[model samples]
Target: MDDDTILVTGATGGLGREVLARARRTGRPVRALTRRAALPDDPGVAWFTGDLTTGASLDAAFAGAGTVIHCASDTRHPKHDIPGFHHLLAAAERGGTRHIVNISIVGVDRIPYGYYRVKLEGERLLAASGTGWTNLRATQFPELLDKAFTVLSRLPVMLVPAGALCQPVDRGEVADRLVELALEAPAGRVPDLAGPVVQRLDRMAAGWLRAAGKRRPVLAVPLPGKLGAGLRAGALTSPARAVGRRTWEQYLAGKASR
Candidate 1:
């Protein structure tokens, strides 16, 4: 890892932060690109302020980087994704980057959500970039599930989508995998990474509440559209490949221990 200078975009995000930390532990030169000027000071990381929508700022970010981890994504404002992704790919090409590693969500193809659609489009663009690339599709993170529980606990009765299945994974594990991918040659579209157990959203929520020492009624409401149907059919879960070892329950336990 010390042989190459790796650049990590979205360095402040949950997954990106872990990647940045892991990269630093490798003793390699790590560069981080963010939209903000001020970031936590780290001697191992060189911070560069840049917006993915504008290609001008990325010139300095990509300079002398052999590998680029494209974890930067727009979930809320998806309008900027296509242009931003295109610009990044072009920059990587021009910079002579050896590989591009992307973190994507599992079941993106089955879900019709706008964000997932944008992610699929990004994947397509990267595939056509002619540069070596690897796309990793992972399940929802445990932290997201924990956040959902916090919101649902506020209600007297939590309303959850019936038949919705999820295999939430650990963000740390996913970050480790991303770093490993960044170091290796691009193996286009690697195997999906997911949690060990397939659980209903309601059940997971209930367990989270119980673990947090809260009690709330769980109402399972069936969703009425294609999006709901996709979730209920377990399209978002990877049954053939249960890769991650940490379960939601184990994650909760670890949190409690901490």
Candidate 2:
């Protein structure tokens, strides 16, 4: 366990927390950045208070960090994405950081969604930054799918958009891969990591209902757009390279046990 510290942005979020926890298991010092000082105190971990919006704040957070795991993203509110990511990359370059590990979604370039477009732009910036970097593109998290279902299940019958393919991964597994990337030398763009099985969006919604002890009938409604067509045509799932360990059922079981 050397004093060489790895900096993790978005430390309070689900994937970020898992990355920090796994990084700490190696006994290496971790500097985790958050928007506020709400993280639990840990001796092995130092907290840096900063947001991605401000380049100065990000520069302060990157100080003394050898490697950076950039898990911070603004998918919910994409308006801040371009500027935030630009500032983050600039700050990392200024701080003389060696390795940068970035987490991205699979099919970001293929999908016509606004968030994915922003993510693709961010990836482009990192790729051309002249720094040692590895970008990990992964599928959606099972937790995220479950949360989406929970929100949609409020209706009398859940209406799933037809022609959407999904291969949701476990956040823990994605976290492990991101930490591994942070520790090792840069490998450029890595292969996409997906779940064990490719499922349709309607089926995934049904699975969620079953896992949560609910019985909401799922109806598939055809969508009329390129984004819907891409999703339905299995653009989001990778069949030959499904490399995840935890299945959706296993994730649900773990949640039930907890």
Candidate 3:
């Protein structure tokens, strides 16, 4: 219940784990919230069991934590995101949490995808919640693309969206910015963070195939609607704000080395 504790939601996930590790380096009391009833002990973090979807055990999670870095999202069931976010906002308000830094995807407003729509609504809710908040919109993460490619590579040929452009930022880089924002006063809707390069999806897929030692041919398939058009238009990229230092090639190289 330290007043200076920084609570991280989704602490076991990719980005959240990075944020939690970096936040611990600052020597402040760090709390990690997870849905799991039991977690392996981590001496630096005070673990809290909570569920945003049901608003279960949230009061104890938010109890005296001055800042919250919200990185939780259920991509499979995107419909639950809004309700979960609403629960978070309510808990923050009730607990008098001083600042909240929310992680969101880029092009959420322009993209027609259901998950992106939910993310956009979450941003709006945080802004109107009467609590101090900051929202960061980042482009696609390399891990997400890697998972997609793993699924698509199972077919005879990889089917990539025709002319689809993607900017795959490293999750760790995004985590760095989120933790930096969490320590500062809330700055609403800060500048977008993007990958170092914007490359065609097919090219990225080819790179993945090479790295993973898969010899599948890549075929660019035309997407027939607004969803396809949005990706082709590069709505998911922020060329001007391409401040992320790590490249997809670097991420793949590191993964291969590991």
Candidate 4:
């Protein structure tokens, strides 16, 4: 219950795990919030069982936490994301949490994707929550793209969105930034973090196929309506804010080595 305690939700996720690792290195009291009842044996980290969607066990999770890195999200069931975030905000408010560092996707407003819309709403809710908050919008992660390609590869060919440009930023780099922002005073909507290069989805899929040693043909199929137009217009990219150092190729190389 230390005032300097930093709580990280969704500690088991790809981005959340990275954030938790970096936060632990700060030598401050770090609490990890997970929905699972079983806790890990990491002595340095205080693990709490909590579900953000239903606000279960959040009081203990947020107790005495001065800063919260709001990394917990339900991308699979985005409908639960908003309600979960609402619960998080309420818990933070009750705990007098000074800062809530939220991780959001780039082009949430520009993109017409359902998940992006959910993310945008989360930002709005945090801003209106009247608590100290910081939101960092970052581009897609290489892992996400890799997963998408992996699934598509099962169909004999990769059916990537035609003319869709993707900026795959490293999740670890994003985690570093989130931890940095969590330690500092609340700054509303900080500058975006994007990958070093912007490339079309087809090219990115090709790179994935090469890295994964797959022999699937890449097919660029244009999506109809606003989604296609939004992507073709490069709504997912942040050319001016390509602050991320790691590129898709580097990530692929590293993944191949592992």
CA lDDT of each prediction against the hidden true structure:
0.88, 0.85, 0.92, 0.92
For residues 184-240, could you state the per-residue lDDT of candidate 4 as single tens digits?
A: 999999999999999999998998889898898899998999989989999999999
When 2 and 4 are scored with lDDT, the better candidate is 4
Candidate 3: tens digits of C-alpha lDDT, residues 18-50 = 999999998889989988888849988899999
Clashes of each: 0, 2, 0, 0
Clashing pairs in 4: none
Alpha-carbon shift of residue 98 in model 2 (angstroms): 1.0
Candidate 4 Cα errors over 4 Å, as ranges: none
Candidate 1: tens digits of C-alpha lDDT, residues 1-258: 222999999899888899999988877789998888787687778999888887658878887788999888776798788899988988887777878999999999999899999999999999999988999999999998788778877989988999999998889999999999998999999999998889999998888877888878899999989999999999889987788988899998977777
**Candidate 1 residue-wise lDDT at 140:** 94
Models 1 onward score TM values of 0.95, 0.94, 0.98, 0.98
Residue 161 in candidate 1, Cα distance off native in Å: 0.6
Candidate 3 clash total?
0
Q: Which regions of candidate 1 are displaced past 4 Å?
A: 1-3
Model 1: how far is 137 from its true place, Å?
0.4
lDDT of 3 at 225: 91
